[model samples]
Target: MKKIILSLIVFGATISLASAQILPAFQIGLKAGTNLSSLNSTASETFSGSNRAGYLVGVWTRFGAVGFNFQPEMYLTSKNVDVTSSSGGVTRAKFTSIDVPLLFGGKFGALGLGGRFYTGPVVSFAIDKNQSFDSAAGKVFSLNYQDQNFAWQFGTGLDIKRISVDLRYEAGITKQTYDGRQTRISLFNLSLAYSLVKL
Candidate 1:
């Protein structure tokens, strides 16, 4: 009987210690942002495009340990390009894609309220209604774009209370053909994120 009582006491103590030590180092959040997007050419063909504005809205989860964290996010994003042809005609093409990024990073200064930096590869899947093209020559064309593409992202953010403000740049790693011309896309993103839960 005495051994049984002692064992119960030890178990209770262990449970209490675990509860005290294992606090929530994970956060879940929502983010919205804007993108300044453009295109570049690597082939012999010359491509000219103006910077276009796009939007992003997403959900993200981050797991942190010892001032470092891994963040993975999914978003509905807009990507676009506006090109001027040699005949002084302009074509505006827009794309919609689901973007997924897994970022590994470190935080500095304060634990929950500080600055962070991350770099990661992102993959995007094109959705239906992916492309809309309009030209100044009264021509409208819609083509099924490439289904998937990859990019590299570098970003920095500042966390204040439950809000984070971030700036990021993404560069394309593969060539995607647009209107029979080989080109790649890149963008600058500015975002604001809010923490919804931490447990």
Candidate 2:
């Protein structure tokens, strides 16, 4: 038991030492990922909502010390959701928007690896100039897309050299309207990013 404990301590010390050796002051990267989204609502008038897959592509920049940093990201997001009304009517919404998230987080590392936990507000702007949905004409509720929306995100990330991965959960701070019925969007987003510039 003593030998095992000593070995573990030695390994941890080595990792911590390596981590302190390589702390970058700044970095920039590009990322792409997929998301699963569901509609959340407490309104009695609403029916059911199911999850749907979506896509996100974007770029990110990070700055500060090794233990604490400020990260900002901009991405183009495509979201899809399927909602069923009480009257058995269904609507499929596929919307595209531009998202900007300003994140503040702390990071820790071992050896050549690191982890980060972050929280931030994400502001989304609608870019559905062509139309938010392909068809909502037949649904029981008429769909109307919002021009802008706000949400909060909490997530963790991993960093290995120049590569990083992030998993985040987002919940709406305000309700969005579709057919005049208000609902919140809740989603899980997973992304892979590569740093192009690290200083």
**Whole-model Cα lDDT per candidate?**
0.79, 0.83
Off by over 4 Å in 1: 1-24, 43-45, 129-144
- What TM-score does structure 1 among the candidates reach? 0.79
Return the top candidate by TM-score.
2
Tens digit of lDDT per residue, candidate 1, span 59-119? 9998876667889999999987776554445667788899999898877654457889999
What residue runs in model 2 are displaced by over 4 Å at the alpha carbon?
1-24, 129-139
How far residue 61's Cα lies from its native spot in candidate 1, in Å, is: 0.6
Worst 10 contiguous positions by lDDT, candidate 1: 136-145
Could you tell me the lDDT of residue 46 within candidate 2? 61
- In model 2, pairs of residues that clash are 142-179
Cα deviation at 189, candidate 1, in Å, is: 0.5
